[model samples]
Target chain A: MENKRNSQTIAEYIKNWSRKHSLFIMAYGTGCGAIEIPATLTSRYDAERLGIRGAATPRQADVLLITGYLATKTLKRVIRVYEQMQDPKYVIAFGSCTINGGMYYDSYNTINVLEKYIPVDVYINGCMPRPEAVIAGFQQLQDKIARGEADNGTRYKENLEWYRANQHRVIKNWRMPDYNW
Target chain B: MAREKETTLYIGPQHPGITGNMMVKVKVQGDTITNASVHVGYLHRAFEKLIERRNWLQSFTILCRFCVPEPDPMELTYARAVEEIEGREVPERAKYIRTMVMEMARLQSFMLWYGGQSGSSGLYTLGQWSVGDRNYLLDLFEDLTGGRIYHMYIWPGGVRRDLPKGFKDKALKTMDYIEKRLDEYDKLLFDNVIFQKRAQGVGIIPSDKAIEWGVVGAPLRGCGIKADVRIDEPYEAYDKADFIVPTFEGGDIWARAQVRRIEARQSISIIRQMLDKMPEGEVYNKVPNPMKWKIPAGEAWAKTESVRGEVGFYVVSDGSEYPRRVHVKGAAYTNGVTVTEKILVGQNIADVSFILNSMGVCPPEIER
Candidate 1:
């Protein structure tokens, strides 16, 4: 029913997403790409218009946005934030780090893919995707929300587990594609 | 009884309180932080341990990741360390380019800090302007180093590559634009009344404590300590470039922010000198095959003034193709962990983020 309504009414869909957009986001900046995350959330990009906000506490956040490469050490925090977030939440993996280990593939300590540890609904591609791209990722998350695919439910939980099992397989490290670098 | 009374809060191994990879346990009574134990090694894939396995040249790329925010200093310090060990002199031209790139990174780092520090105070306008202005500089870094943040451009021999044509002119023009925007921020952030009230008397540290605690960069400078690696111990083109190290006597958040603002203006001066007295030569000296270049067995401590504070790399090589160990004796350990916990004790809950930003202690740097 939600999908049908979303497909039928795009304007109403956007309005609904906008109304609840003040998503408390975890700072969660891990790599070189983090420099731009600040750029996107601020006035120039104005992530607030969509209700996207950076949250100091995960319990308050509606979105868990990961910007760029996250080391294994950082991965634990990502999980904690994901756990703290309310059930009806969304996760967007920004830039190369969140999608795939952009440059740190085969790095001694880095986790090549983020999907293993946390449930990510959307992944934006770029070495460090620009602030413009971050906003675009947010809009796509809203659209996904409208479609009801991104709603926090049993489905998102199941997908998070699936990705964790295949985390290494999902990310390719050219240094040691087959393993044992 | 004490443990039960204290509320334990975990900050970064992945928490929003600290940026990057780090987790600290803080026990707070009411909103005041009481006890803090910083737990690094979250991001420590053992960078110091790994450096021993890779050749001298290939190790450069890995070192920059240690301090992701202002990576140029890592590259510069490592290169200088290697140069010191090898007794290789960087060409005059390479020095100019290195100076320019380093200053550019410094300026961008300050701009980014301006946003984070002010935003922590609930001053969003600084966040808006500083981050936007920083992109203009990052664009320059992107053009110069090919990578925006971790420019593996600075290396042991000298630098990885020379400036592309018109880069000098473009960088100078960008500096002018950044200077104009700083004035706008001065009005919005520096001169604003709210920032003053929130940050003025907060996080007071004495000069003796600042030195004892190993506070370098802006925090040390804010406490009226002119402990800048660039001025006290000049490296690269720092000796040639004329600029003043800005300091403040307040020893508070406002003082630290002021030092950064003043330094941003001086970074522009250094960049202009780099361009005006630009040397003409190759960017890098002859570095051996990256996969097999062994550094001679020795220890070299190279420190550079990053936007945050003194960023230094301590490396020891065992006459192998790789380094024996590489340890960082930088600002974050003291500022991010020890001092952050100490000063946050009596402050309000709202000042936590602001205090962290003002100190410019990125958690990953400390944790790594």
Candidate 2:
């Protein structure tokens, strides 16, 4: 029994280590912050060197990097995308707009707080954070994944009702699929 | 002949190949698009309504957000409109600085276009190279103004500050490096067989229907028309600079690409002349306290030739610190919506994004 438990702990450690290295980011450029993302992913910043590459679809992506502000209409799509991703997923919200609405605080269509609607593992603060800051935010997430502290995906699944309430308040017409995950 | 069944396909609001957060709903029959329609407003922050509440000075901050890739033209147009309404004079040196800044913006915006156009067509190498090289221009912008993406330097009456120490030499050096790299890009991208094959006869905008559809900028020039706001109605220091407005016969993606290629060189030449001819003087003619500033009840329209096309600001003042109404006429408003929807019909579904990028469809500009 003791030997079996030891092998299971080793398997868990290996899983966490591999997950920390490879992050397929679904970069949803929701606002002005989207412009900075190309710089981060391209040759100058070379985010791929750190194993952070862009995924074309939500099912394949390990990380959802929300570039900036989300309008009510976009928020509905974002929630759908987030739910479509598989287990052990993470989210990195870029720009101050995602934190507290930034300059678009008073805009009627945009939401002030993003965390209330979706679980975020890291938040990079700026009007639009520079490429270096974006890389740093990814590194922070990498650290969290390695230490097994990043479990927002599970938290989201557990508190689906509360998130659905916040999402429904902003989105007037809710035609989303039921959250089975 | 038997007909294939029709099917509906939605491209974006999240697709990787799309220029920004906008959607294209296309009806296809056996891989050929029969009809297409553009759906925008994903990136809209309601900038026009937000501008209504801010004071005159505060409005400049949000103007840059109207079009993310090219923001300088928005600032220039708004400043020019306000200056015209107040009948304020911009110093000679300030004029030169503003002209130089706008040209730099045009160059950087073209770099982004090179990336987007090629990337959507499956040439990822060009996107990587051009976008990486674009950082040098961003570095120059960071030095002159405190910001990279949104400069907000151009203000009513004049610019916010003078050239930083040794800025001219730095800018000239960067321009030289970019010019040298343009040749390498020509070999890698413009001369490649696949790119030519994909771009040559696709997404054709017939010359006869170009103006009728409200096309402007490189896409219009690509239709063999010589319509440029700089030449027809010279603003700022453009009257002093000499440059050619390049035009091409074919209205396909290749023609637009050629128009932008030659135009980028002309921009470098114009920037060189503006730097050489720049005079020494105060950069700004200070206005009254910004919070309490007011102009006579009047309206003015000012336009600038941005990389995408003509970006105009129509400002109406109520003789108060706030503007009564501000309407923006962005090139994408016409080209991205009506022009794109009309052109995409009958084209292959594979070329949807390729055609969209060539027209310079910026979504924020469309929705804002």
Identify the candidate with maximal TM-score: 2
Model 1, runs deviating above 4 Å: A1-26, A30-33, A43-52, A55-60, A68-74, A94-113, A125-127, A132-148, A156-181, B1-3, B6-17, B20-26, B39-42
DockQ of each: 0.37, 0.70
lDDT of 1 by residue, B26-141 (tens): 77888877776767765655566656666787777677877777878888888888888878879888988888889888898888787776666666777688887787888898
CA lDDT, every prediction?
Answer: 0.75, 0.91
Clashes of 2: 0
- Please state the Cα-based DockQ of model 1 relative to the true two-chain complex: 0.37
Name the lDDT value of residue B327 in candidate 2: 96
Of the candidates shown, which would achieve the greatest lDDT relative to the real structure?
2
For model 1 chain B, give the 10-residue run with minimal summed lDDT: B12-21
**Candidate 1, position A158, lDDT:** 59
Q: Name the lDDT value of residue B39 in candidate 2.
A: 94
Candidate 1, residue A112: the lDDT equals: 67
